[model samples]
Target: MAKGMMIVDGQRVNFDGEKNVLSVIRKAGIEMPTFCYYSDLSVYGACRMCVVEDEKTGKIDASCSMEPRDGMRISTNSARLLKHRRVILELLLASHNCNCTTCEKSGHCRLQELAQQFGVRRIRFPDTREHYEIDSSSPAVLRDPNKCILCGDCVRVCEEMQGMGILNFAYRGSNLQVMPAFDRKLAETKCVSCGQCAAVCTTGAITVKNQIGEAWRAIHDPSKRVVIQIAPAVRVAVGEAFGFPAGENVLDRLVTALKLMGVDEVYDTTFGADFTTIAESEEFLERLKNGGPFPMFTSCCPAWVKYLENENPKYLKNISTCKSPMEMVGAIFRDKYAAKDAVDGRTTYHIAIMPCTAKKMEAARPEFIHDGRPDVDLVLTTHEVIDMMQETGIQLGELELESPDLPFGLGSGAAVIYGTSGGVAEAVVRHCLPDKSKNALREISILGLRGDAPIKEASVTIGDTELKLAVVNGLANAKKLLKEIDEGKKFYHLIEVMTCQGGCVGGAGQPYGLKKSKEKRGDGLHLSDNAAMFKRAERNPVVAQMMAEYGEERCHELLHVSYTNK
Candidate 1:
């Protein structure tokens, strides 16, 4: 597309390769209100909040669906456009469940924000919509049909971005609603519990299930020892709820807040990520020696694991048996605390604070439970932890920095970067390489592993052979790659697949953000990696000591797991 000029609200705006007028208008510094206009998704044009009027002819249309051309003139904030937006809001509110104060997405809901911005003080129509029962069948996500505005954001994200058409519009005309086929519960379908639907939902219609109450009860129990592990991505993204910059690392402050809130001990999940990197690298090397299962897929992401079990079970043997970092640490803590319980007479309640909603589902997997007790007692999202901090009257920004607990808290730089896409592959490469010098680490970092691209491919020479590697984020991209691999069009020695775009940094349970914010979060992880004392997982002394203490057989029993097809 050629560069063009247009007038948005009387200001001349230049557009170069912008897809829609809304992009050009936003580029012109105009804040256009929208409900269903997501940059990464297809244009629905269902919500007329971004309607603009043509200056030459008194006609109005959605800016998202219209392409910008040379010599185009439009009024974005005319009285007519405002009235149109207000009317649309009013109609939406008429049927919507308006209990904003009790909603999970209260302060962050787009519908509530736009309602106040457009002065939608009242609804003119009757609430004739039927009250639907809330669906809490999924362990990760909650669905409330009453609060839906029929924006189709969730539908498109699940289909286009995730390659999972678990959600779609049903019925006709005024009775249309988004739901699974035949209105099946999310868990009953092939839903991977990624929570991408909840992430894109503009209202409280869909949300992460609240586990804050469960977390609080465990914290308040004097008979229990509450130990929490914060995932690598949580540190960078959790601060967003408390007015911190998008990519700011608030781990130290978060550690202080968790301790102040009565947590017995807080550790970094990266410590476990180090173990994963080492174990996975060993597994890859063994497979390379055997010369079979050509590409061993990573098993860190629960959503990706579930997708394989549900949709592509034939390739289950190719997935590495290494437990996820969360589960690996949880199992170690469970064993550690079981001994402490025998001596101290206090039950240990292990909690995992993670950026992925699927972690909640992952924790509840049957394999992670032993003797009727779960390894991780509870799983909380980044948002839930922020909410808990706010409820306890602890402001993250106001809190002073404090170090994480020793031993299990210290993680290598390779482990810290596990929060983003390709970080796992890069970390494993760092472990595989014989050279441990800074230059070798720098060379490994530039292996096309770090970026916002959905799928990244690279190669590295190890010993006598060059190993082909691929890192993919987003299930849709992974699905495409899988198809190519199945057709013999693509081959790799090792593959890393993260179900969410940009890896856990762009997880649905993190602060609701698009591509740019996710990039900032990824950058924060890299910065932390750059400042670490050790660049490779194999260099982490704590991990090395733990491996020695646990021994080979015990380590294999605890750190590895096999999945059953659902």
Candidate 2:
């Protein structure tokens, strides 16, 4: 961290002046209004609301993209700045239909905040009222270009965060809107449906295919059993729904809240991940022994799996045959556990709490069907969970500890961290090694990936063998890895790919509000992982307990699942 002397509002302050102005300004308790400026991604400086006048340069520049220098005097709130800001926003409003009263993001829109900040009273530019159509074609997300500010935030996040690069600027000028490859609808493209775009949109241009109301309907319906399975990455970010900051553990409260919402049974997907590791590790060793695919890719991320299938089908054989933890857990609860427990019932409604939107597509995949019913019945984003709680009058502080149901209930720390990038591989390495020693597990922390750049790569030795692994957190980066693998440039024994950046921490399901940027809740998951007693897949007492009661034969035959190129 380098030092720089910056004068803001006539007060001199010491700033870590190496990077952009947004970094230093926020550090000094000053809010620099912005769009097109995300800390997790690069500063495009497109929305000039962060414009500040420099004493030395005599030119106003976007604080987000500017490099602070020593002795630089910056004016963040001058009349000149406001005028320019309002003009930029007003011109923006002309081509866009905000419909704030009805918009889901009305209270939390960055564009709306900027409008009020600049005191833009009237639409100076014609409404053109020239309407643009909304594309609700994607099962996971909907794109309303009519409300898009064209800040390129979605495009940038898709490119810099997820690395999917799906939302590229198409055509030119007035006709230029974010369009996917070949201008196809999102459903038809290599979109992956991670919904990072929806998370980044300042307006309600993009949103998850909301199913909270549907969930509520089921919860109230006596006929349907609304069983909820919480994903590992969800524990890290779901706290934000209840006003908990990033990194704060609210599992107890969350569980209580879900129980209040009328879920018949609340389970953690970590158990699924735990089961997944058992199956995957066994499969990994099998691959090594039989000399199968050199790289056994993790199939836990449906988005990544879809990318491989659609973009690089040649390497399909390299993918691990294990089903995603969510689906795997779903299959057991619906088919295996139902039969074993002798719970003769009608159609089972299984709902999964996930950090990625692509999961909706994954759940809908006809291939996921097991014994006539789909493995996963429904998928809800993190944001949707918060809505469900609010709708059901579930208070955050009043939540109590309600134990998750048995059979596929218990999970280890290894299972919890699967929400984060590199977590799955780390869990596999910890439990999958031939000699699962505590010393080896304690000494190694396989968490890789760096600096919000999306993908991370690292290697470690397991017993007599050194294992090479890659974790692609961003969807765009997943594309890059698939390309690298297809091109025969990079090689690894295993790869874990999550569709969202920062793993599930930056998931589309997380809460959102105005104020330019939202305080992230990422710690809840990490803290839960660190404090959990069981941390390995091989030795999770709950999974072991289940196996003992049901027999290893039963666990292997039903608890685990398989995948293919299709």
Candidate 3:
């Protein structure tokens, strides 16, 4: 062992002034178990699963919150520590309802994995935990307190990251539980249903509502023609759910899988994003000229839309009137395809494969409903789509690749970047530029808008129009930016706000626990964009042809929708 290195289990590891022993051990390839220790959040040392012993001091402390010292000999798995962890698992298991087969997070639960890691045969502690009824009132998220491990992951994420305190510790002592104010139903509270709580949940305590059964029913129905639109982020994230690593673009395989699953028609939501870019860019240009609003906010993110509607209704008019890509595509499906395919609009079912749980709520929005049927009949998250593929025995890795159906299939590269935070603004700038200007396209590509930064701002001139653009992800960042706008400290002609961290790539419905998955997914989208034939939305032949066939005014009427302050 070296003099400056710390020894753990007879292995000398480099110490790089890591704030906690857990990080040092992890850096040395040691897997320490933890429930309450999130890398981005404040450490609370509640679980004590990572407790390590100092051989010299004869003391055990939580490795997550404990600072590492040079030449410290820490035993990560002493006999006493093993016994302590086993008992802790037993206590957690005793309180938790052991209905693993039907649980939404059965295979993915961290607590279950830890229990298996500790090799627990049975629980010694009696089941004294109080049971609570499951709350399925929210269209996007479901809450089952019986499965909660009291990790406070949901609580911290909601407050610290989102700036929305929808979930918190309620009651006192033994009766303590997580709930909205006054223990109100999640649907009744100020919950925007961003599903970050569900994303951070280690168990099925919170999860996106499963709509796979509805999709199956729609497909099985003889009268209904089931059509699906796949979102941009899903292509990158869905592969990870299977055997493939993160950021693998399996769009062609996904299309093949959908065809095998009896999906009647497959379309790309990026086609609709092309429509959005055209309409939203025109609207922004008009607003900029007429001074409709200083900063016209992008309305592609449904969760961000809901947040503005609920928390800041004053800016509702400032949001773009363009419907989200999914909804816009649904409108096109219902209006054009029904007559073309000789099927009644009532019998045609539209399903959206999205990377967001909030899209479920957005699909169910009253504004999107017409003739007593929703524009999108069902919303399947990336997780649910993977489950569907597995259930149907479709081998995604081995399947022969297939292209999406025509008309709404080929999307421009501008549409491809919509999955990340700064992507929307960059896409808009690209669309605004003329196709012959290769210099403008190159400039747009490197315009310092795309990154993991919470907020990014850039000023660029496209086609004689000097545009001020701001791109923001995470509602907390959006809130701060909005405050700056209110104070007149920040000024912009256009702003793109995504509710999640890295836009749709970091969506709540993505697969859990993939390191740097969002960045990889974003990179995948960029790679896909580089390979694409069309770079600008204005140059997309299908969208341009559609606009020519059906006048832009009529297309706006059909594809665009309104917002409400509910």
Candidate 4:
């Protein structure tokens, strides 16, 4: 009942309503090492690295799970605590496959960093671990159990955040390992390839599938005309990999780098977003007019789309049929854009640089291919784009910024904001609303359908009807919304769902440990949206020209695709 205060290392610190002693210590600007602790997930208290000495009680407690009480005295880093941490790291390393030199997470592995920090020079225990085969069955993610420390971050994130318990602890004690149910391969499970597991994993236990070699192969082929499109989120987050601050836009520099890497032309996915918006807005308007399937879910997020198919098949009819911006651009490049530029589509290698790992799976979908050739030949994550740029030996900061190529390069403000959670709903209202007045699109923002909230709702007047819209991020949030919709407790004319928390900006393939990166990256998109020449997708001259040239029927043929019920 009294004001909670803690003495951390002789300094009087206020708990400030933090749930645990670890939170209080962290809030006081003291670094307490942790392995199984994630701010968003439930505390396991399995990692003893955060064990702190309670001077008042003369007891050691895992700070992550310990309650901060009034006048509690805590020693964060004592002699005994350091020795215990060192021993814990040593024991974890004894069985860990120490292939840091070749490990995918070599530079960013938390276990390796903690071991180095704790001065773990040698392991007293013998290396008795057996060979565990890598699980690279999923096209978007790879699982290497040898690198796992049983911290349970991946298992917790997959189950808690994604609502898909694809990864879990299996077996018992020394023989225990995290795996899919029945220890089946990841590809054989209900996993939707969102890659949140890889994003949360502290070690190389999980990682995005490395396709840098495949990209290089296409680049090296002289006969191939390589064209790369940069996604909306990539421009803001990719700069972080090069020591730049989060949400730093390096679009021009990115284009320059791709050009130097033998890319024939660099395009912006925002252009595709423009087309997708036009098509999707039309679809939403049509559905609204029909008065059926009241809440049409946004299908731009491939992971969310796949989740609908796999888990909520009855709602398949509720999902928008329009392909994502990535696929829309890929379809255009493979069918019409290449022909307009006098390049054979067959010889052109279309690569999409994206934020989400699920995009890799999306690009490989048979529905998006024609004549056995994928519309998008390769998919590269934000990290992959940075790695490829680094390999070129070009300093991104030193290079001059270059604009994207014409026709497929220009986009509206509505298109660029598609990178974040509520962005799709905002773009739809901006573009689809019948009113074209300058102040009409501004109403969407005034309705407060933007920000970092897990869920957002707004009402807009279209013609004589008022439509309610909801935007939700994180699959867990989406699951809760779906339950409400199914039970008739909540209803909306439109709902936008992004699988990852904070949408694509917080994707699994983003740079590691960039805290608050999603909020910052999303801010960049909003700034771009405000500064864009045209606020609505319909105002884009390029989109108008495309519509005039392709007509409504053909435009749908190129930018739209149907989903399959699993």
Candidate 5:
């Protein structure tokens, strides 16, 4: 990554010089309408909607595909460019479905908005009127081929971002549809049910198999005790569902809203994050002492675990035996928290607010059930939870703040950082290295890996062992790194790979406004991370209380978990 200069529309700019024309334009506060040019993943020039006029060449070029030169004059919204783009849209609508009024994605669909914005009132050519069937067989999502724009956003998201080749272009040109091999149902295919596809889809082609209605039914039930554990990531993302800014930690509001919606025992998943880190650090030391696997892979991400099960089952032995923070925390409440009578032990139900749709499937996995009951009974994405809160008449801006309940309540900054990339690996090192007599001290800036990046690398020393760390938020980067590791090219002691790009901060469950910033929203989680008296996990008072209550060795049994391949 080196610095260089590039000229865009007569404005001199400093760039890595390798970015595409669209990237350069965006860097200059100029937005180019595009269908297939997603910022987090690689470019796929399937849609010609981003066509722009090049002054020097006098040619209309797709800004996403064109590379910026030293002096390239480009007009992103020129008259000729708009005309050409509109014509392209007209042709697409003629062959495709354009029933925006009746479409499920009428308000949110990118294609629908673009059509209205461009004033594409009618299809110029004779309507092809093609009909396609929707596949609703998947466990966590549904696919409607009729709504697909063939922009390859879903395919690229699944293939590149999730590292799952469960989707591909089936048939050529006019008959092309994104589907699993041989048109098999997604549930039957090697689909990990990650919902990364739904995250990028511009149309209603894909969406989560939501069970919020069931939650509402249970909430209205007089006998059922509905309890919820809010994940760390969900707190930062829920605001987006109701037009709240992205990355805004609205946990206090979220808890208040959940309670308003008739939810009992509003718990924090950070309790589980702290508990997980404690066990993970111990697991690392045990593997280091015993002659077990050399490089331990994290298994908290169900999507990543599912990807490994489908693509690289042989490497399953390397995955750390630790349940996801949300799952682990829910289990504790169901087993331990209930015994203390937080809620009626017999009927209390566990609900989880997460920044992931994959969590829906994760909760349903047979393994997640123990003692004839699933650890989590219901899973709500950030979007669904926010919707629930709004429906119950809770004012998000005015909800009185309440601190988390004890007995797996208080959380530290390390738990807060779990919502970001590399936070898991960094937290583990902070908690474990000090006990191992590592010379390195805790540092908040883990090589600038906290924010959004394709791939971030760092190194640290634990006693004599020089631990190499790589944090990948995007699955595309994970695929590249895994290829290198599979080929026996490089060695890393630990790898923290999140399913969503930028970690859960950019999760699928997030609302549209996640593209915005946190400073403007003004939440306590964001402020707590900055002003924490002790930032690390090992120093957290609550975690120390847990260790004191149950001897440190007892953590391995209470919090630790293992994964299986195939």
Candidate 6:
């Protein structure tokens, strides 16, 4: 591929290291529609929606599969290309279930958007595809095969990004469908419930399970004391649905919206992250003193924790016993409300607004249950919360700014960065360092801990001990690092593994966004960190007070949890 000019729709465009004609055309400012083309995944060339006419050869082929050349001339939207794209969309719509009025992904679906863009008013062909049963067996995701267009985005994302081939194409031709092996339910397979498949799905074929009805019911119940906690990543991304720019923090406006929607109390999940940071750092120190289980992997990500339980159980002991920030906070709220319940007779209905679908699964785990009730009664994704606001006829921009409830509302700067990749490692470093000065915090911030990289390594010396740390996002990258450690090719004292790329900011439950959007979200979290009054977890007076009130035994009981190999 040479750096030279090429003609795209009669305009000369320069191509330098662009892998495909689609990239070159996009670079030249053409919004070429694509269903099977994703920059982060391998080119499949299945949909043929990005086909372009080669002026010289008068032939049309998928631009996504063709390489950019020095003197290539192509027409992106010629009359013939338009016809082809329209027909392609029509054929897809013929087989797809067109019940958009009630579809979960009605407004945001790429298939619906493309069909409308191409003016597919009526499907030319009759619907001949058999209806398939919707699979809602999984706690985190739902599968509706009838809406599938065979784009294979979910299949590729699960296999390539997560290194989990739990989804794949089965059968052939008209009967073809994407599903787990032997047609098993997702919950029955070794699926970790990361929901990356749902993240990349073009239609409602795969989607995060909806809990909005249950959430609304809980809020309306007079006997229920509804409580909600918003995750750090959510504040940065939720504003995108309401016309705010990506990475803009709208926590105050969101608080107002939730309050208007009858939420009794609202808090920040970062307060829980603060507790996790302090407790995890203490656990790391204990491991260092014992001189064993060298690499203590972080356990805040339920997807990563489930991956280890499913795929590699031998190393379970190496994982930190500390519960995730969401769980820790849920447990605390449960305890606080249970005491209040004894007097007022109002049951606590705890809800978590998170950026990850796996949080749904995490909340349902038996380990987090006390007596017969789960700590977190419900888990809603960022998208779900947005839907709730919209359903309530509430406009976020119109709401007056409001603050979260006291006690669990405030969090340290270190806890705020837990939304992005390497943030957990950086927060732990901030805790381990004896120096709490501004200079120390600045140096820690620049220790290659912030980026879109899949894996980041750093070394720090704290109190006569040198610690090597690795922060890994994407389960595939984590798997690669684990293999290296197994082969004696690498070593580390602490490893922070986030299942989704770019950490929780790129979680499957977030608004559909690619690499750049995730970067913006990460930047927003760092900005929040810089604006915080307290930098370290230890400096949070509320957390310190809670620690003293709970004592060592109660803290261990609430904040720590052990995982099994199953």
Per-residue accuracy of model 2 over 1-566 as CA lDDT, tens digit each: 56768888887778763577777888788888888877767778887878899877779888887787788888888888878888888998888886888787777788888788767878878877456678888988988888887788888877776666788888776777777877688877777777778887898888878877777777787767778898876665666556666556666677778877677778888888888988888888888678768788888878777777776787788888777888778767765546633564544578998877888888988767766677787899877887777767777866776667775678888888777666777788777655556676665563353223456777777667777878777766777777787688998888877776666666676665321212233345556767887778766877766657777677666655455554
TM-score-best of 3 and 6: 6
Candidate 4 local distance difference test against the native: 0.87
Q: Which ranges of candidate 3 are over 4 A from the true structure?
A: 1-5, 340-346, 463-465
Rank all candidate structures by their lDDT, best first, as comma-separated numbers: 6, 1, 3, 4, 2, 5
- Among residues 3 or more apart in sequence or in different chains, the pairs in candidate 6 whose N, CA or C atoms overlap within 3 Å are none
TM-score of 5: 0.86
User: Candidate 5's residue-wise lDDT over 1-566, tens digit each?
Assistant: 43556656667776675568777778987767778888766888879887778777788878788776765677777788889889988877776666677564567888777888899898779876467777887767878887787888888778776667788898886777788898888888877776778877888888776678989988888777777787777776676665556656778777777777777668788878887787777788888778558578887788888888877887788888888898777666666646555445447778888877778888888877887888898888877776667667667877787755565656776777787777787778777665523233335354444556678778877778777778887666788888898789977878888887667766777664333342222233445566655666677777677668877556555566666676
Q: Where is the poorest 10-residue window by lDDT in model 5? A: 515-524
lDDT tens digits, residues 1-566, model 1? 74889998889999999999999999999889988999988999988889899999989999999989899999999898888989888889999999999999999999999999988887888988988889999999999999999999999999999999999999998889889999899989999999999999999999999999999999999999999899999999999988998889999999999999999999999999999999999999999899968789999999999999999999899999999999999889987777889999999999999999999999999999998998998999999998998898888889899988987898999998899999999999999988888899889989898897988999999999999999999899999999999999999999999999899999989998888999999999999999998888888899999999999999999999998888
* Alpha-carbon TM-score of each model against the true structure: 0.99, 0.90, 0.96, 0.97, 0.86, 0.99
lDDT of 4 by residue, 39-140 (tens): 889999998889999897779989999888898999988899888999899999998999998998887899999988878888889999987999999989
lDDT of 3 by residue, 103-199 (tens): 9998899988999989998988899998899999999999999999899999988988898989999888878898888878998988888899999
**Candidate 2 Cα errors over 4 Å, as ranges:** 1-4, 15-17, 56-58, 121-124, 336-346, 434-437, 446-457, 479-490, 513-523, 545-566
What are the RMSD figures for all models against the true structure? Answer: 0.8, 3.3, 2.2, 1.6, 4.0, 0.8
Runs in model 5 deviating more than 4 A are 1-18, 23-30, 54-58, 68-80, 94-104, 122-127, 241-244, 337-346, 392-394, 435-451, 513-527, 538-558
Q: CA lDDT, every prediction?
A: 0.93, 0.75, 0.88, 0.87, 0.74, 0.93
- In candidate 6, which residue ranges exceed 4 Å CA deviation? none
At residue 285, what lDDT does model 2 achieve?
Answer: 81
| Backbone atom clashes (below 3 Å) for every candidate | 0, 13, 0, 1, 1, 0
**Model 4 poorest 10 in a row by lDDT:** 337-346
Which ranges of candidate 4 are over 4 A from the true structure?
A: 1-3, 337-346
